[model samples]
Target: MFFKPYMRSLAVAASLAVLAGCSSTGGTQDGSMDGTGAAGGVGTGTAGSGQVSGTGMGGNGAGQMASTGIPDVRTIYFDYDSDTIRSEFESVVNAHASYLAGNPNARVILQGHTDERGTREYNLALGERRAGAVQRYLSLRGVSPSQVEVVSYGEERPAVRGSNEDSFAQNRRVVFAY
Candidate 1:
């Protein structure tokens, strides 16, 4: 009951072809051969490093992971009784500018605070001025005006509750919240 040489050779060739096809087009995690996830293996939906199933490509792949959550908050300090942005805070402003530039849909609320010095009305004005100053700086740096909202908390929200210089210094600052 031996088959002919040609028939045996044909059977072997067919088996090899099937094996090659199976290996080349691997199944996804869901057991689908269309490069999608079958159950435990990599997802065929998208090629990414993370195990999470995404519809498209995963992380940025340029060594930077895509932000899956809210962006981190960045704070910048101002001089005592002044709303002017300090030179040291240029980097912080630039970072905010870059973020706003990259994410047009993103927005920030700039809260200005002042130390307990003058009357509440005066402090309010000072805080407002401070927030305006920061807003101008960010605008100059290319951040859209619509992306930033300025608010002056005045002496209402002090960073450090005290009458000392250290507390005042801490209170006199601008906070950026997203």
Candidate 2:
């Protein structure tokens, strides 16, 4: 009986932690989703060459697959339904942030995306949050706010087409277009 109360308290704390982990900064309390008029394209490419091919957000047709001096790790991926950046991508992002800091004229577009599972609105919001997380990380590392542009394609543009976990893993990512 002595340990029962402590176990109960522990259980409550764990439940709260799980709830907090699943909370998102997207959508209204009424379940209505809002869209941001951000612009960007979708696609994936070889990391070594740093080439991305896709239509520009507004039909610019400027998207091409070529290494334009971008770093090898241009894409930062996130886990399922979470906007937090994974630990493995931290150094890569930091490298990009450092490069941005060194070159004020260098501009990058952070295209946020998500897998096809959640509601369109939720995915979009999650994408935005993921991109925002990277933006905040860059800012923390001394990158200027003006140097980065954020856009969320959500589930509309996927890197891979499939319902399997592999495709979903590839789909959930933030690509840096320079």
Candidate 3:
């Protein structure tokens, strides 16, 4: 009886732990499936049928790619279904801002993306929001508005392919194309 009670206690503890972990964040493990816009409908559903090219910006098109090449910082990853830029990408965006400040004529393109989870339309809007977040970050840092343009490819193009969290994380990102 003692051993039986102990086992029961252990099982309950384990179950509680599992539930707690999942509840820390809102929505299901698959954000897009929750139907709550908290995740912005960007979830890693599966490989999308639309296989558009995913050429994230690495350098500005005006020979910047050939001249300056790509800096060490090129890609910024975001949380599932979120357009808020993470603090980790602050340095990269600041560097881009500094570069733009120095090169008045240089232009940059911000390409936003989302994992294949939500509806295509939702993902497209989410992608645009992500790009706009980056644009705002750069603009706040003294980068000229004329130097920036934003595009949203949505989930049509993925940096990585898969429905799993790891792949989804890779696909949810903004490319800093100069």
Candidate 4:
């Protein structure tokens, strides 16, 4: 239950070193936390030009048009302890569904997340349910089940780091990763 005075100082130094190591910027071509570029698509470009040129969809398929259209909104938030899609996000889901249906070659991963509140197992199941809800919605809209995958990170990854209502609301959601 207690540490020697020297041991306490050593632990503090180690913690500070780890924190310092974590503070460096990422190496992504685009300034996103994820290494996948701005559009999350396979693209080619010269360095420092601020332009990407290539075939296929770009970063998570955002701004890339399919037969139906492009889906700019790739994330939809959820309420506490619920897997139901909110009314406001219906259109967003619809757009993504249409895009997938229109482009058979396109594939997407639905990542489900939840706020930190429940037990680990409970949170993981809740995340899966949230993602499955979106997958079902897409299927009903004419998207093939084969083109979509679902993953549950639960409370492992938080969009905003905090223990507040705003942070919780932001964390509970499904993201369409192309």
Candidate 5:
């Protein structure tokens, strides 16, 4: 807890180095964090440019890619301390369910996660329940149970790092890795 003058200087330098390394100029001259040439963060959302959108549904899908060429959306979010899927995200789940039902041989791994607000044991159990909820939803919609495998990481695997609500929102999620 005590720092000499030299140690303090070294600590400051290390902190600056870390901040400098992480400072993204929004990814490009156009201020596009999406790495696309466009200014918007949604990389795949260029009009008639055929870029894949951020969510697989909008940016790249059978329809989006076929018509505009965009791809990939793997994460689905959940409410705080709850495994219930929001009604707003039902379409996303439906899309995956439809895909699995249509392709009998296709399989997907559901990775469940939780924010860092609970005990380790509780988070693990919550993660499992979240994944189970997704699995159940998919099965009810016609995706075979055998085609889905669930894994829970609880608070161990967070997509975002921070103590604020914004970060916590990002951390509570279920990712469908095909």
Candidate 6:
């Protein structure tokens, strides 16, 4: 009877030792569990300071407002072979409107480009169409025509240099310069 009780105690001790070993192994894998590691296992998550760390957006995790000092102006993209301003560009138009409204003296140059697939003259026309489309939008947004200048580079300057869709898409664009 005494041997049975002693054996039971030894078994219990062995089980505890095994558990301790497993726990130490886990600790080695992830030290943050012990609270002594950097970030305290929170892993740089959103802390009340409006700073989101380790979220992979780059910068010092100072949140959206800090990442972009001034709210980014939305870029308006155009469809292939068309200069018509799409509905998606409405926000960009509005943002530009607000900026121009606030800064009356600010002047913008609209530069348009086209993919390399078209003849130079045809691409020039297309580029002009693209710039004109943006000018029209800006005019509609209450910016005076004098404050904006439109120029088309056609196939002369491509934003990207490849026959692929990605490069073509990038090449067909209107850029705003202030």
Per-model CA lDDT versus the true structure: 0.53, 0.57, 0.58, 0.59, 0.56, 0.50
- Using all chains and alpha carbons, the TM-scores for the candidates as numbered come to 0.59, 0.62, 0.63, 0.62, 0.61, 0.58
Better of 1 and 5 by lDDT: 5
In angstroms, give how far residue 175 of model 3 lies from its true place: 0.4
- How far off is model 5, as Cα RMSD? 17.7
Candidate 5: count of backbone clashes, pairs at least 3 residues apart or interchain: 6
Candidate 3 weakest ten by summed lDDT: 1-10
- lDDT tens digits by residue: candidate 5, 54-144: 2222223332222121114567665444454543344567677777787888899999898786577767876877777778778877889
lDDT value, candidate 3, whole model: 0.58
Q: After superposition, which runs of candidate 5 have C-alpha atoms over 4 Å from their true positions?
A: 1-71
lDDT of each residue in 1-178, candidate 3, tens digit only = 0011112222222222222232232322224643333354544321112222222332342223222434456787665545544434445566677778778898989998887876788778778777876787678768899999999898888886777666777887888787
Mind giving the per-residue lDDT tens digits that candidate 6 earns over 1-178?
0011112222222222212222221211111221233443432111112211221212221112322232254344444444544333444555665576557787888888776764688678767767776676667667888888888888798765777545655666677767
Instruction: Write model 4 residue lDDT over 5-98, tens digit each, in one string.
Output: 1222222222222212222221112111122232432222111122222221222333234446557678877644445454345556767888
Candidate 5 TM-score versus the reference: 0.61
Compute the lDDT for candidate 6: 0.50
lDDT of 2 at 22: 28
Which numbered prediction scores highest in TM-score against the true structure?
3
TM-score of 6: 0.58
Sort every candidate by lDDT, greatest first. Answer: 4, 3, 2, 5, 1, 6
lDDT at 168, model 2: 67
Report the backbone clash tally of model 4. Answer: 5
Say which prediction, candidate 3 or candidate 4, comes out ahead on lDDT.
Answer: 4
Q: Candidate 4 vs candidate 6: which has greater TM-score? A: 4
Q: Quick one: best lDDT, which candidate?
A: 4
Better of 3 and 6 by lDDT: 3
